[model samples]
Target: MFAIFKIFFGLGWVSFGGPAAHIGYFRNTFVEKLGWLRDEEYAQIVALSQFLPGPGSSQVGFAVGYQRAGLGGGIMAFLGFTLPSVILMLLLAVLSSQLTESSYFQNVVHGLKLLAVLVVADAAWGMYRNFCKSPLTVTLCIGTAIALLLFQSVASQVLVLVIAAAVGVRYLAHGNVTKDKPASATRSFSWLPLASFFVLLLTLPLVGTYSSSVQLFSDFYQAGSLVFGGGHVVLPLLQNIVGDQLTQDAFLTGYAAAQAVPGPMFTFATYIGYELMPSAPLLGAIIATLGVFVPGFLLLVGVLKNWQQLAAIPAVSGALVGVNAAVVGLLLSALYQPVFTSAVITPLDLCWVLLGALLMKQFKLPIVWMVICFAAAGFMAPSVANLI
Candidate 1:
């Protein structure tokens, strides 16, 4: 447990970029470096998280930790993984007024955005090789990407996954997936966890009508529960939920801050909650964070024992393949818009991404070092801009 906590805590500090990058970091550390899980094992966790709503990357981390050290380890992993981003976001919320005016800081954020492009590109490539092996899977990847690029929203994203699953069941049903099953799932388990998951989903809305805090929890929780293709997909839902509470500038600032931090992108809630309830920032942060995260964990717990069994079922396996392929497409579409379009603003910016990608692929520079270099570049970009 200590080992799990320590590693995740370290990752929390440096796991910048976004969900795709975070997945890459986890794959590198746990699968390649530590041998905590095999490639296929890690892929299964990722695929499961991709299918579920909530913070997909964080759920993957939780699943990985659960596999390592029981339910306790899962909780510890969530804490260690989220602690840094939560703290950083809260601090940013408090100092948002000052930080927004700082040009150097803005440049640093710009650099990080560039880093996001490189990191996500690397992740997409790696995931493609690992998950999109068959021609049908590759076609699903492309088709999902085009569909999402055409209709970009939480609703469309979910639709794509559903369609993909249906296609998978129809097409890939007979294909084999090989992996050793975990020992824990072999034991008897209860239906209570699954029951509790739906109960909360149903009850939260009713309770929310009476209390503002409950409303906040419900809004974020609902966003977490329903937003597919996590990270970017959650943004519009949150924008609508807190539209009246925060000014557009303040909300945009928090969104920018979220991009700069590590851990789960869902920690954007920490900043919003702190801003909304300044008198009780800590409490607000905690409530919002847990509200957004708890549903995913609950769902994971409910499904834990059934995962292997479900995997063995031919129809389920086919749907999983479809879901996995669609995930790659979702990532591809995301790479173009908010990531690529937002990051690469000029020829120079494109050059920076190319350079960073080389350093990442050829030199295999540590993410921390890449962060430092890009931050320096960001700090200097303003000066370079003036000269240009």
Candidate 2:
């Protein structure tokens, strides 16, 4: 248990660029570095998680633990993997105001922002290439993106997602999917712990912690539950919340801070936490941090209980292809809002993006190296400022 927590928490500390990037980290650490799983095993699990509804990385973590140990290891692994993110987000959430004001800090923020764009793009493309089984699947992806942009309501967007799923399932049922061997399904063995966690969360309101502190907690908790895709997946939902209530500067600052951090951008929970619920800043931060990841842990356990049935679903896999294609669109949208909005201050900054994207696509340069080098360029360039 301790080992699971330590490794995953360590992953939380080092994960940068967002969910897609974190997936890379998971593959490297668990499959390549530790030899915990074969490459095929890791790929199969990723295919499964991307097929499901919850956060992909957390699901992967649970799958790993479940593969190794029973329910106990799975639970420990889930919690451990998420702990570093929870702690970092809470701390940063408490200190968001200070970080936003510093101009020198913006360089690192912009650098991280660029990498996020590339990572999301790469992930979406890979998924689309591998899983987009038909033109209808392609249409579903395009349609989802258009619907999300056209209608701003969360309820409406969810309906579109469901529609996409239905379309995918129909496509799969009609098409062919044959496998030689069946995957193992996980059974429920830890309902007690699951129920206990739920009870604690459910009764928080009755416990009388419902101050501004609790409000922040509630907001991020709701955010965790509602968000789909991965970390980038959470952004549109966040925009709906932050863009309306907070100052543009506050929003931008918090966003910038999120990029510099090593863990998931879900830690943006911290930034919004401090701004939305200022009283008991640290406590607000803590709530926000934990709240964002709560869904990941819960869903990991929930999904593992029915593991094989999920991975075996052809429609689910098809829908994942569509969703991943949609993810590409989401990241493209992100390029303008968070990446370009802040980073393209100077004409010279444009060079950094072009170079960074080229490096990733053409030469296949490492993202971390791109972040470090480009950040230096942003600082050293004398004329760098908002291009517009």
Candidate 3:
């Protein structure tokens, strides 16, 4: 258990580049270097994460630890992997008020916001290429995006996902079925975690009315339960939940900071939680962080023992295909509304974004360097404007 915590704690500090990159990091560390699991076992964990909601790469890491050392190891893995980002986000929340007064600091925040734009665009486009290959799937992606852009509500998001799943089961089910393999011995899984997940999900909102902290937890928990694709897709849901409580700039700044950090982007909740409850910021951060992460881990624990058999079901596979495509669409909508609109106010901003894209795509520069370049550009923007 200590080893699991130590390994994941080390990873939390250096696992940059969001979910896809984290997957690579886990593959290298657990599969190649440590020999903790076979490549196929690692692949199955990754696949399971993709099909379920919450932080994708974090779930993969947790499942790996669970496979290694049981439930206690999973908890250790989650704590070790999430601790660094939680600390960083809390510090940023505490410091942001003092820093906002400085012109240079404001520019730096603006620059990081632009970085958010670049990061989300890359995620949306990459997922599009991977998930929207079929004509039917492409239509679903475009339709979902258009629907969300028009309606822009949590209900609309859920409705679209449901419809996509139904469509996938009807049409995309063809060719997805596989022949049955020889039955392996079934591993027993406790149902308590799964039951607890639903109990909290349903009961939290009712209890949340009496306490601010409970409300905060309820909001994050709902977002974690529903987010299908990965961390980027959490943006719109969170925005809908808390956008009114905080300024748009503050919200985007927290998101940009998450991009700059080196762990699960879901730690963006820590920043929001801290900002939301100024008097008891640490308590807020803890509650919000747990609320957002707990559901996914619970669901993973409940289903992991049976995952091989469950994943083999054709309808399940087909539905996931649709859900994945719809997720890309949801991200596309988020990219346009809050990410692109909030970041690119002038033609110069657009130019900066284009340049960042070039560096990311053509030169393949690291994310840390991109953060530095954008910060510098933001600092100099005022001088450049004067010259122009």
Candidate 4:
């Protein structure tokens, strides 16, 4: 258990470049170095995470920890992997009053936002290739993107997913998509976790009426519950939640900070909570962080127990394909509206984005170094512009 915690804790400090990158790191450290899981076992875990609606990489980590040392180990793994980013986000929230007004700070933030743009673009393209290969799936992807681009509401997003699922069930269920093998250990089903998951999902909003803290928790929990793709996909959902509470500049700044840090992007909740409840920043940060994560973990425990059976069903498998394509579309829509619009302000900004994406793809530069270099460039760009 201690060894598990120590390894994940070290990873928390350097695991940048989002979910796909995190998966690669896990495969290298756990599978290649430690020989903890076979290649097929690791692949199954990732497939499980992809089918679920939450932070995929974090789910992968938790599942690995659970494999290592039961539920306590899973909880410890989460704490270890998320500690660095959560702390940094909380600190940024506290300092936003000063940071919001600094031009140099704005420059640094601009660069990080560009980084987000590049990251999301990469994610969308990869998902499109993997999940949207067939013509029917491709149509669902494009249609969902167009729908969300027009409506830009959570309701519309949910509707697209539902429609896509229905379409998949009607069309793709009998196709050749592979299903992960079920664990013998999980053959016996348990209902308590699934029951609790729904109870919380339904009851939290009503419970929140009596307490502001509960309301905050409920909102984040709902966001986490509904998110499909993973950490980066949480952006638009969260932006809506905090839009009334924070200035656009401050929210974007926090987002930039999230990208600069080295853990799950969900830790951005720490920044939101601290900013929202300055009188009790630590408490707020804890509540927000836990709120966003609890639903995902609960769902993970509930769904994985029955995943094998469900995946075996043709209709369900087809629906999942559709859902996956729709998720890519949702990310694509988000990339255009808020992420692209907010980040790219000048021709030079576009150049920076293209350059960053190229470096990330070709050179495979460490994300932390890329962030630092781009930030420095942003900080000096205005002076350079004047000289030119």
Candidate 5:
């Protein structure tokens, strides 16, 4: 358990690019490379994580943790994956009051925006490899990708995903269900865990009034439970929750600061917690961190018990395959909205985007360095202001 915590705790610190990148990172490090799990099992977890309510990356972190240790392992993994960014974000929130003037901070933020685009692109590529294996999948991936790029909303893309899956299931798969073993439901729950989770979830909104600690906890916990897309999508929502009700300038500044950092955006929530109420920053910070991350853990465990049921349905399985393909499309849409839209403000910027893409796919450059170079260049360029 300790080892699990240490390793995953370390992962939390470094894992970047939101949930899709995190998923790719897990697949590469744990599945394809470490041989810790079979591909099919990993896909099962990926599919299972999607059905949960929070960020997909958060759920993946929980499942990876569970796979390594069980309940304890899962908890450690989430802590590990989340702790780094949370600490960094909290520190950033503290620092934002002063750090806005730092050139280093600005440059880093500039680089990060570029890096985030690259990271998301890499994530899309990985998803494509997994989901674009069949013609039906390709159609869903491409069609949804186009639709999302046009409409440009996560909710819209989810609608497209559901509709596409339904059509694909009824027509493409001929309404056939996948045949499998007669699966029985998991008898894994204790009433205590379920009851406690519901009770906490129901009352989370009422928490922050007691103290800043309560406020921080409630804010993050609520976000952890409610966010549905992935880590990136959580950004604007988190900003609204922490920033709007707190200090607008400080929250926005911290968000900018988080962009400059090298880890997960979820960590940014920690920064919001610490900065918003610093009279007792430690308690607020700790509580806020736990509150946001705990939902991710619960979401994973809750979904895992039902994963076998999804695996059992052939029609549902086919629909899932379509949905998984749509996930790739959804990612592509995300790339366009922020990545391409922000980065391609000029011809020079387009060159950089193409260069960065080539470096990633053709030369296989390290994402950290690729992001850094382009971001620096972009920040230095005369057109940088136009892009930002």
Candidate 6:
């Protein structure tokens, strides 16, 4: 457990890039370096995470720890991996009032927003390559992306995924059956976590009316529960939930900060929680963070041990393929909207993004170096414009 915590805690400090990058990092560390799990096991955990609604990479990390130690290990893994961003986000919330008006700070935020564009684009492309190999999957990916681009809402997101799953079952299930035996009997599996998941989902709203704090938790919990694609997809849901309470600028700033940080982007909740409750900021932060993370963890725990059995089913495996393709589309839509539209304002900005992509693809610079380069460019952008 301690080892799990230590490894993830270290990762929390250096895991730049988004969920896709984090997944790569986990593969390298746990699979390649540490030998904690085999390549196939890691892939299984990742597939399970994608199939479930949650923070994709973080769920993978949690399942890794769970595989190593158990539930306690999973908790430690989440805390270790999440702590740095939680601290950074809370601090950003505390400092944002002083920094928001500073021109230099605004420039840095802009840089990070652009960074978000590059990260999301990279993730979308990578997923597309991995999941959209077949004609049906390519069609699902394109269709889902077009649909979301047209109708941007949580309901639409859910609808596309459901439709994609049905399509996959109809068209893709025939030859996908696996012969692996079930890992454990159903009677031996624990259902407590699933029960708890439903109980909270049903009861949180009932209790939310009694306290603003509870309402905040409920809103974030819903966001975490419903976010299917990745952390990037959480933006619209959060914006709709808290937009009236916080200014668009504040919300966007927090998002950019999440991108700038080096851990799970879901820690954006920590910032939101602090902003929502100025009086007892820490309490709000803790509650909101826990709320957003709990449902995902619960669902993961409920399904982790039994995932092999489910994956062995031809229909389920087929559905996963469609789900994965749809996720790529969801991410592609996200890249264009809030990420690209919000960040790329000028032709110069587009050029910078292209250059960054080149550096990442051809030069193969580390993400930290990319962050430094983009930030420096942002800081100098105004001065360079003046000279021009």
Which candidate gets the maximum lDDT versus the true structure?
1
Worst 10 residues of 6 by lDDT: 176-185
Clashing pairs in 4: none
- For model 4, give the 10-residue run with minimal summed lDDT: 176-185
Which stretches of model 6 miss by more than 4 angstroms?
1-57, 64-73, 174-189, 200-268, 272-281
**Number of clashing residue pairs, candidate 6:** 0
Residue 359 C-alpha lDDT in model 6: 92
Superposed model 2: Cα runs more than 4 Å off? 1-98, 174-201, 209-256, 268-288, 313-347, 361-364, 381-388
Better of 3 and 6 by lDDT: 6
Candidate 2 residue lDDT tens string, 1-388? 7787777776766566555566666765676568898754565566456545456667777788877776677777767766666665555555656755666666555665555555555555554454455677667656665665666454654566556556656654433455521343334334654574466456654643556556556556666766665666676667775666778777766676666777666667766766676556666666777777776566556655555455455665555444544544443443445445545665566676777779877997654476676667656555554432
Q: Write the per-residue lDDT of candidate 1 for residues 160-185, one digit (tens) a residue.
A: 88899999999988645444433344
**Displacement of the residue 210 alpha carbon in candidate 5, Å:** 5.9
Question: Residue 94 of model 5: what lDDT?
Answer: 58
Instruction: Give lDDT per model, in order.
Output: 0.82, 0.61, 0.80, 0.77, 0.66, 0.81
Ranking of candidates on TM-score, top first: 1, 5, 6, 4, 3, 2
Ranking by lDDT: 1, 6, 3, 4, 5, 2
- Candidate 4 similarity to native, TM-score: 0.69
The better candidate by lDDT, 1 or 3, is 1
Clashing pairs in 2: 15-262, 93-270, 345-385, 345-386, 345-387
Model 4 spans > 4 angstroms off: 1-77, 93-96, 175-189, 198-284
TM-score of 5: 0.80
Q: Candidate 1 versus the native: TM-score?
A: 0.87
Each prediction's Cα RMSD?
3.4, 5.9, 6.2, 5.7, 4.2, 4.5
Q: How many backbone clashes does candidate 5 have?
A: 10
lDDT per residue, candidate 6, 261-357, as tens digits? 7788889899999888989999989988998888899999998877756755777667777777887787788778767887899877888899998
Mark the 10 consecutive residues where model 5 has the least summed lDDT. 181-190
User: Quick one: how many clashes does candidate 1 have?
Assistant: 0
Candidate no. 6 TM-score: 0.76
Native-to-model Cα distance after best TM-score fit, residue 185 in candidate 4, in Å:
12
Question: Which residue pairs overlap in candidate 3's backbone?
Answer: none
